[model samples]
Target: MRADAKKNYDRLLAVAREVFNEQGVEASLRDVARRADVGLGTLYRHFPTREALLEVLLRASFDELTAKAKELETADAVDEALVSWLRETIAVAHSHRGVIGSMTAAIEDPDSALHASCLSMRASGERLLNRAQAKGLARNDIDGADLFALVGALAWLNDQPAHTSRIDHLFGVIASSILTNGVPVSV
Candidate 1:
């Protein structure tokens, strides 16, 4: 990439992050271009589509989440490691506000730009979940896909004003349900 084009790409990503943070993942691409002081044609030349742009914006965070899963895989407490990864996944999803829907849809669509990252992240969480289940610490009925869906659901709940105060309590309830002990946490 040329210097000027690379500069525009970087600025677009920075502005898109801010716009998406304020207006959710579905925020207008035109707004991102406008905020970045780039023309719509330039944004299109760089991103091609919203999903493509999101793929760039979220790729690093997804990679980090996968790395965290790897680190947690060897934790002394399998249950704690699984819960910790779940919390981290939810945080990542919630950070982009309305991205859960896109992620969930993308996971099922191989052609989607976000599919690879979503799949890697899901597989990472699945590994942790599988480890916990192997130790009889997590539910046997759930799989990696289920864990991914749960993350999406939890993130969506966080977007609701009515659920804001109860989000932590709800997370605890959901986490307890996944854990075999039946008594996970209150927050």
Candidate 2:
């Protein structure tokens, strides 16, 4: 792709991601084009369908999370790395609420891009979880699947406008429970 074309494509994807997060999957492509200052044809050229655009945006987010996990793995403190990654994952889930909802609905469809991304995310998460467990910071019994499930539940619960503060409290409780050892308190 030409430099200008690539720039336009990237801008469109960025704008579309924000709009989709704010409005939903039903957000208009025309609006995305307008926001990106690109012609409608340019948007269609890069993303032929709404699903195609959504797939690109969702894949980008998953890729970012995967990269962050890899970086966290190399961090000095294993516990802090794992906690930071989990918190980042929660934030990503919260931001892409509608995308996640759509992905859940499409999980059973073999041809779904959402299904592919979901599998990729699981594999990426497994790598991080395994590393944390090996370091003896995270609980060995709680596998990647458990963490994934927890993230999904937390994401959905946190997406509700009225439950934001409650979700923060819930996350704190979860973190404390997962981090606590059986040792006696010093107090």
TM-score of each: 0.98, 0.73
Indicate which candidate wins on lDDT: 1
Off by over 4 Å in 1: none
List the candidate 2 regions with Cα displacement exceeding 4 Å: 2-11, 28-45, 105-110, 180-187
Looking at candidate 2, the ten consecutive residues that score lowest on lDDT are 178-187
Residue 63 CA displacement from its true place in model 1, Å = 0.4
Clashes of each: 0, 0
| C-alpha RMSD of each candidate structure in angstroms | 0.8, 4.1
Write model 1 residue lDDT over 1-187, tens digit each, in one string.
Answer: 9999999999999999999999999999989999999999999999998999999999999999999999999898999999999998899999998999999999999999999999999999999999999999999999999999999999999999899888899999999999997666656
Ten residues in sequence with the least summed lDDT for candidate 1: 178-187
lDDT of 2 by residue, 45-111 (tens): 9998887788888787888888888887788766666667777888887887655566655555667
Screening candidate 2 with a backbone cut-off below 3 angstroms (N, C-alpha, C), the clashing residue pairs are: none
